[model samples]
Target: MTVTDSATTALSQGWCALSLLHGRIETHIERALQGGHDLSVREYSLLDVLSRQHSGVGGHLRMQQVAESVVLSQSATTRLVSRLEDRGLLNRYICDTDRRGIYTDVSEAGLALLAAARPTNDAALREALDEAARDPKLAPLVAAVENTHHDGRA
Candidate 1:
């Protein structure tokens, strides 16, 4: 179905608002996580994904898998992994069967950091949503975001 020009305009405006809201929320969470736990949002996300994917073969995942899981480019993910490894937050190993494959697992320290950062990030998100929802026009979008999150968690 074809959308009218006005509908298209509204859609574009909605997208812009959503993008701005996303940036604000991300910034809030990034600052909170970094200030409270010395972890960047992306780093925390990588650690969280590693913890979730930990299983078998020293409880690690291939580098490619981690890259895909974190939605980061392979090079970016590699750099993050290196940083984590240097910080003793995670460890890397060569896959036994695949000579070319490298695997990574969260260290005891990484898990601990992730545990500490989770609440801080969550609280930041909640606060951001609350602030945004104060605007009547944004309440519906906030609800939609909350519902989407709630549904994802379920």
Candidate 2:
């Protein structure tokens, strides 16, 4: 094969590995969260994100921002919020300054559930990474994930 072909093949392989690693981690976390907290990964993620909100300026997130932070479409985020609100785990309100703007916050019950589930989520993530690292094709990706920081820095 030509050098260009080799480079393309390598890139394709890396992409596949990344996708696989993501899927594995998500599935593992999903199972753990569901089994322990009756929450899907997406639900847990939404609760966690909303739990961080505060009353200070720039501390709150709009619906669109919440959707973006949770990596969901606006409609999907709305549905998720509705589900949680129905469960008394979330509360939604219109922005005082912007009638069109809506904000969401985790309720007291949501905070309790999230606190209980945080360890399960973290454990599942670590377990998934450890398992993935055993595979030669995925070890690098696993290492890269582990070495990454919450601020998006290495």
Best by lDDT: 2
Error of 1 at 76 (Å): 1.1
Name every residue pair that clashes in candidate 1: none
Summarize candidate 1's per-residue lDDT along 46-153 as a digit string, tens digits: 999888864555456777778888889999999999999999999887777878877788899999889989999999999988998887767788999889888996
Worst 10 residues of 1 by lDDT: 53-62
Q: Against the unseen true structure, what C-alpha lDDT does each candidate score?
A: 0.86, 0.94
Clashes of each: 0, 0
Show the colliding residue pairs in model 2.
none
Candidate 1 lDDT score relative to the true structure: 0.86
* Cα lDDT of model 2 by residue, 1-154, tens digit: 9999999999999999999999999999999999999999999999999999999998889888999999999999999999999999999898898899888889999999999999999999999999999999999988777678554885
